[model samples]
Target: MGHVTFFGVVTFVFRHSAGCTGNAISSPHRCILVPSFEIKGKNSMPKMYRTKLAAMVKNFPRYASANQPPNGEIRSYIESAGHTCELRDAGEFQSPADVVNLVSEHPKFEAALAIHLFKAGRLLMDIEIPFGVIFGGTDINEDVKVEQKRVVMEQVLLKARFAVAFTDKLKEEAELFLVSQSSKIYVQPQGIQTDVTEKFCWTEFLRSSGVRTEHVDELRVFLLVCGLRRVKDPLYLVEVFSKWHCENLLNVLVIIGPKIDPVLTAEVETVVKRTAGVFLAQERCQQELHAAMKRCFAVVNSSVSEGMSAAILEAMDLGVPVLARNIPGNAAVVQHEVTGLLYSSPQEFVRQSQRLLSDHELRERVVRNGKLYVEEHHGVKQERETYQRLVDTLH
Candidate 1:
């Protein structure tokens, strides 16, 4: 794939046969000149700069932390393109001094990128090195609600040379809130891949959860995957889901993810203790989580805010039908009644779950369409190429 590159931008010449031998790319729009490693320019041979990047990213623990996985994957693309990347946890940057300390520590780093706009994107402010911003969910969806934070976010945007949003909807949100950044912001949907443990025992997993009723073979499991936090809204569907489970012995609801917040974890723990068929499973690795998704009836998302959800995309790629909260982020990925079901409230979720249970043809159609959507949009090759293009800008 050939990418359009700017005249001064040191980028990959993707068009091999287009006489892009040297790194200098010629096009009306900017071109991604470097398909293979080569360089050229009209004035003179382009100067080769440092390949090291200081990538400050958010990382959550235990299981399926959204930020860390994509951070790792995209950097892998950057590294494969011959860039040395240092992935620092963005959470550690409490103030501007922390960022200055990081830059001082890595004297050879040519550039830096902050993964989440609100969390670490502010670090880009007052830095001399060229930098970019990657918008995470809460940064735009939640943080922009505050006046002080919005002012700081605007500063971060003014300083950023480039930015990446996980979805077009997210890009729109950023542009709407901050204004005049649409050109620099690129819409890159996440690449999808899932490796399930073939030997994983669904029965064993169920038994361990301790929320399954008898005749487990006949039960339908719905997975709600997210790090336990207020934004994730882990408790959103609990009351209705518990009621639905009690009304039918063949249904169960399992909440699984790392406990990101101790306070929220306690609240969920208390609810699951008394709620029948509502189990709280410990967060599993990506492989194990995929195995659960494969064996489950459907996956659910009830987030108050989202950037691009890896779990939702992973579930679709795995051929698991999804029931997501009707939000811009989820809606951008999931087409209601086509790719997956979308419910506005808990009652709607119960009704929709029942539809997924009773309507055999609908299930098959949704599953098929969801899988096709993933294949078309989110693939390993697509992401590798996108990141390769993105990293080239840092040059």
Candidate 2:
């Protein structure tokens, strides 16, 4: 997309042509003109400018341990747009001043992107480069409710050239605090692509996770993938799930993800060890994890909050049904009983799960609908185009 500049403000010029060759930028309000420059070299190679991505990174063991898979996917999309990105741990910085110092030290970077308002976005405020904040689940769902955090977050939002929310509901929540900049906030769901290991062995994976050999033939695994964190509520249905398994002799709940919180990891270990039909699988890369997810009966999300879960979308893309908590985030994506099942309480969760398992027609219908939803709304190509346009607009 062609961008125009007026006194250092970036404004995109929209064109109407069948063969338009640039990105189509979308915003909640009118585009502003800003100082703009070319991001290409004489030889036609896309000019490379460093882009810093600030986010949490402590517990994950996969690529760029501090950033989650969604961040990784975003990074890849940014690179595809011809930019170099460096991930800085938002959790490691002690204060906003520290974040400013870090960005100032990297003079080559043209812009910045921060994930989550309180931890990531707060630090990047007052920095020289034009920065945007991508709202994480807690940013709108919990942190905005805190007076102290809400104050800092509002400041960040005002300073930011733009802000991103994964859903319209999340954008509305952010607008409740950032009333003035509601026009700068855009709703864009995370994109997803599911790929599994070529040589995955379902029987071996089941055996390794402690499923009984005799029961493997009839085992109906319900995979719960999340880091061992309090917000995830990974063990929410463990006790009841174990009881159901004992009675049914086929149901099992397997929890898998990185050990993000040490204290929660210990708690999960203790609870999972004592609970029957509940196994804690080791953390694996996204590809391997998706492989395991495909071998299961369904995927369960018990998170207290979510910023448009990549895992849930991936499950849908992989043709797996989802059973998620009835929170605003999940509810926004899942059309309860059509795309997936949504539960408001533990008892409701068990009842819904039972219904999902017993009714094959319901399961197939939900999975089919969920797959269609993911393809229509969360396609990777759409996400890449959106980010490319957003980045292109940065001064």
Best by lDDT: 1
191 Cα displacement, candidate 2 (Å):
1.0
Top candidate, metric TM-score: 1
lDDT of 1 by residue, 218-255 (tens): 98999998877788898899988888877886788899
lDDT of each residue in 1-395, candidate 2, tens digit only:
21111111111111112222233332111111111111001111123222322233222233112112365555555554444444444445567576455544422334666667666666666567677667767778888778998999888788877777889998988877755687888878887777798878778877787776576757889999887777788888888888887887788899987776788889999998899889988777767888998889889889888767777887888999999988888899899999999998877888998898789999999999999999898877777777666655555
Which regions of candidate 1 are displaced past 4 Å?
1-50, 61-63, 66-69
Residue 154, candidate 2: alpha-carbon lDDT: 88
Error of 2 at 234 (Å): 1.1
Residue 311, candidate 1: Cα error in Å is: 0.7
The positional error of residue 370 in candidate 2, measured at the CA in angstroms, is: 0.8
